[model samples]
Target chain A: MILFELIAPIVVMFALSFLHADRVRALLALSAFAIMLPAVQLLLQDKPFPLLGDYLIADRLNTYVLLLASVVGAGVALALMTLQRHVQVHPRAYFRFYRFFALFWVGLEMAILSNHMGLYWIGLEMATLSTVYMIKTNATRAAHKEAWNYMIVGAIAISLILFGIILIYAGAKPVLGEEAMYFTALLGAADRIPSPFLFEMGFAIVTVGMFVKMGFFPMNLWLANVERASFYPVAALFSGILESAIMVGFFRFSDVAKIVNFSHLAGFIFVYALLTMFVVAFLIYRAKDFMRLFSLSGIEHMALIALFWTSGGTFAALLHFGAHAFIKPALFLSTGVLESQGRYHIAGALRGYRGLKGKLFWFVVGLLMLAIVSLPPSPMFFSELYGFGSMIALAKSGHHLPAMIAAIVLLLFLLSIIFYRFVELYQSMKYEGEAVEKRVYGSELAALLLFAVGALALLLPFSLAFLRSIA
Target chain B: MSAFLTGAFLATLVAALFATRLYRLLMWYALNSLALGLLALLIGSGLNDPALIISGVLTLLLKAGVIPLVLKRLTQRFALTRQVTPDIKVHYAVVLIPAILVFTFYLAEPIGRMVGGNANSVAVAISSLFLALLLMMEHRNVAPKIIGFLMMENALFLLGTTATGGMPMLVELGIFFDLLIAIVVINLLFRREEAVE
Candidate 1:
């Protein structure tokens, strides 16, 4: 039945999690396959698949994100095969590592599929719990600090969302009873809820929690700190899988606003998006490290995504995520290459990598940044264009006002900040003409090329339809 | 009875705000969860809800008993410094706590409109959330930070039992699972922290 098909992947991945230490690679590969098979299967189908009487549903958004998450999961596993040499691990430890990694994988899958608020909370908590272990793979002082900060912050965020969920229950109990927290049930009964004000309060609270989970503005600092501490593969899962999962949470929360015509939710999204755009633009200039710089760019991308979502461009939102998810792991792991080789000089001396290996890394990283900045030929460029167009459309639909004008002003400020930093960095490098040469290791060239192709392929006009027209 | 129990639970968290000994903080958490459990049980009996009754027993057995015992053993296993007050000055905390309570009371006015039960209890539950966040923001040490997280969960349980009269059974079970697993993983991280030290 449909239930078995949906449940099999998690069950298999959970089983693989118990593999012995020597089978760490196998455990990882099988876990990736477990996630991918069902994801690909779902993607191939045009219809939504609901299981457990609609508590867990796989729709266009969920399936597309799953396929995207699996791609990142596979990329991380594949990249690890070549790059995991630096992490020396005993058999027992290796087994333990993969077990938690598999759990994190399964958790993300569950989170996307969940329709019941309760199931969604559990899935997210599972992912967060596993991440605490993942970030601790390096037992250094800074890593420990980052891990604890991550754990504490995640706990707080999850609890806030839970409180919000309970509020939804409180508000809906009289009309819909306990089933009010179930997405399917709530859909039919949302309007009959006791008070609209309480409903907005709950939705707003949940959105705040999602914002933190997605690492925007004020909560953005934690991602960089945690990434700096995590193993590269584990961090890739976060950038790719976990971040997208949180975006789904955002989409779902925003859908409630759409269902009930709650203007405050739209206003909330616009305010945070503008503030995040303006704030991180300045913060990116102050980033002292490369990973930190990339992490800050994540906020910018998320902000753009928020803009499109608030403007009601559902397809644009999905396309932006598709582009970002595929491209981020390559960008993240290349930075891993630079950091590991001790040659990741950001905006400093013209001490760049030389020779073939250096040339490949330099080219890949440059391409990644270009994609991040949404230059032409990159998928993000198109997505950003669509986002702006949609915002204008939203304005045409009676949404433009003093607030939208202020948002545009904020956008202009963000543009000036970004261009200013680029000029500064360019001039700084120009001053130090003699660049340092650094060596790259393994199939670095082939991997970067592969990633580059994958990223570029997402931008094709037809491929955009694949995601945009998703169910 | 439910209101008194929830109030006693909030009191433990406030006391923990001032307590310097880590062991005492854990005990306070245990007592806080015990109050939450009793409140759940009392509410279940009053409403005649079997799901709430099951939730109450689980809260009593796991959060009140098992989790604190695990944390106690964790506290004893390492020569960890018992940091009761990690960062914020007492005067600042003293002023902040009441401000949080009042702010949440105002917050409850909007929240109070949706509740099917006592509006004052709803205000208290919402305030407990702020108080828990204050506990977290006030501390810097890992142990106290972790305890602050536990306190947050306890506050949420109060929210569920009082505001909604208890969530569906399935939701409560998922929550308890998360709390327990979080502690286990956190204990591992603590061990690694000790090893790093």
Candidate 2:
């Protein structure tokens, strides 16, 4: 069962490529959804098994990530179906898109579930390569450039990671005595590591490499370019699912190394997270393109919340991850719809929607606005509350300053204002007469409803417990 | 054993310096790899490990013989006649290389004491890594970039063999696989660049 969950997606994706018919692609996606439902249930049971002599394994921490990937995978398939219906592209290229997206999804799953360092490295490389193709799927000049930047940076990061892995193995050889690079084994024998200084140096380099891949500030210039150039569904997966996997990597490393106390690292991460949120908030104010604005906002908020997780705010982090993953894609997909109708500007789209007097569009806009801004009863609100509570706990433990915690909360509140203020400006835009007829289909509407309701219900007890376990 | 390694190391140093002549870079790389392979062979013979001896011989053939030949062919195919001018002039590189070598020896002395291994091996590995970086920074062309990447890999291999007495065979295999994939990808990227031009 464990091996099946790990390898099934890769096999399914490879098989999907051989199927030429659109109907088959749709069926494959439905089958994927069916496979996912059982997999997530099994994962929630928290069983662990090693495959191929500890090279790969499944555990509780990755179970949540796999479930999230599955949901996003299914959602992307549905969105792709909508895209195929709307765009008059050739069937060959369209099917290729499906095939590549499936491969990308499966590769990420493998990356998250990998237990051995070398296997993890391979999985990450596979995921990066697959996503490169997705980024260049449309083959625009901008897409090509973005893909190039992503690939080069990704390869460099992987090389550094590999180097770090070698250093760790060298450092561990005296104690473990040969060829034992499994995470659990390493963690169990962590105290036997010979040179603490070398270990720290290697860990720092590895962290920086992973941080670059995670799109943290200063290393995140590639994020906007890639997100802007990718198709909407691809962008959605990049922001929602893939970033979560990178976060899982960070979490796993921290769990294994126990190098610095979470609070100490959280202090450094918190400062950058705040800077990212503020900078992105300012950019969002000036952003004209709707998709770009949402992408920037997603990057900002995700970094801040991820920092919160590092501060021992695990429950809050999981909640925010789930909420953002659900809401951001729906919003991006709507932006795609607007873009498809030739309304590139957010202000213009808002004005046009008003002219059409579309209640459904307004409802989606309202739900997303509420969700992104973390209004009451929204999953985001609860997540942020728990994050703040964790901050307070850290303060009481004397690991963090109370004043600093208060300031971060204040900063978040102000950032929220900036986000909604743009929505206000967008809503208030003067009408240019109905620019393009809205052609939203039933599938899109169903996807939006599913995301909205799903985001709301994810705050329930069972999910909260799962979040806490992994936190 | 120490005396033999010392002589081989001195020969390698001389060869590396003399290889600055435009026509002799491949010969220099071969000599460097030969010295490394011989060092590995001596270490293995001292440890009485036939597997390590086999690996050492394989390295000598692959790195010393095959790789340099391939690089020579690549240089010829590209008509890359322009001599590589070091970012630091050759005279300056000569001076800087010894300074780096001395510094690395100093840095690795304490580590060598702790690990109870040859300090010179660690120093050589560090110097090779620095030299590879220098190689990469000095050259702007694709061929040189490939050479730089290969040199980095060679340095890493040296670190694996000398510092830790050869990483797990699985790791060695993984590194080899990664390098193979990287080279293929680099070739494809260069092809795309040529097509664009």
Best candidate, DockQ = 1
Q: List iRMS for all predictions.
A: 1.3, 2.9
The 0-to-1 C-alpha lDDT of every candidate, in the order given, reads 0.75, 0.66
What is the per-candidate TM-score for chain B? 0.93, 0.82
lDDT of 1 by residue, A1-471 (tens): 544654565566556657664555655565555666767777766566775566778887788887888777767766665555555444555556566776786578778888888788888889989988877766568778888888888888888888888877777778887778777677677667667677777787787887887677688688877887776666667888888888887787677666665567677788888878877898888876667776777777788887788788777777788888877777777665555534345543334667777766676666666666666787777777777777777776785665566677778679667656655554554354445554566554555665677677776777677777762
Name the lDDT value of residue A433 in candidate 1.
46
Error of 1 at A257 (Å): 1.8
* lDDT string, candidate 2, A1-471, tens digits: 656654665577667767887567767667556546645665756457554567667777777777777776676667777776654445665666666666676667667777776667666766676676676565466766676667666765665566566556666777886644677777787767776544544555566667677666666556776878777777887777777776776676666455423444555566767766666677767766766777777776677666667667888888888888888888877666666655354444644443333557657766686678777778988888888778777777774576766767667676776667655755643244356455666667666776787787788888888788774
Residue B79 in model 1: lDDT: 58
| Model 1 Cα lDDT, one tens digit per residue, B1-197 | 76688679878988988888898988999999899889889989999999999999998999889988888788788656786664778888898888888888898886676574568778887888887787777776777878888888888888888888888888888888888789888888878877777
Clashes of each: 2, 0
The parts of candidate 1 lying over 4 Å away from their true place are A1-27, A86-94, A347-361, A419-450
A43 in model 1: Cα distance from truth in Å?
1.1
Per residue, candidate 2 scores C-alpha lDDT tens digits across B18-124 of 34343475676677678777877887888786656776787788878877787677566556654754456677777887787788677666656655655566667
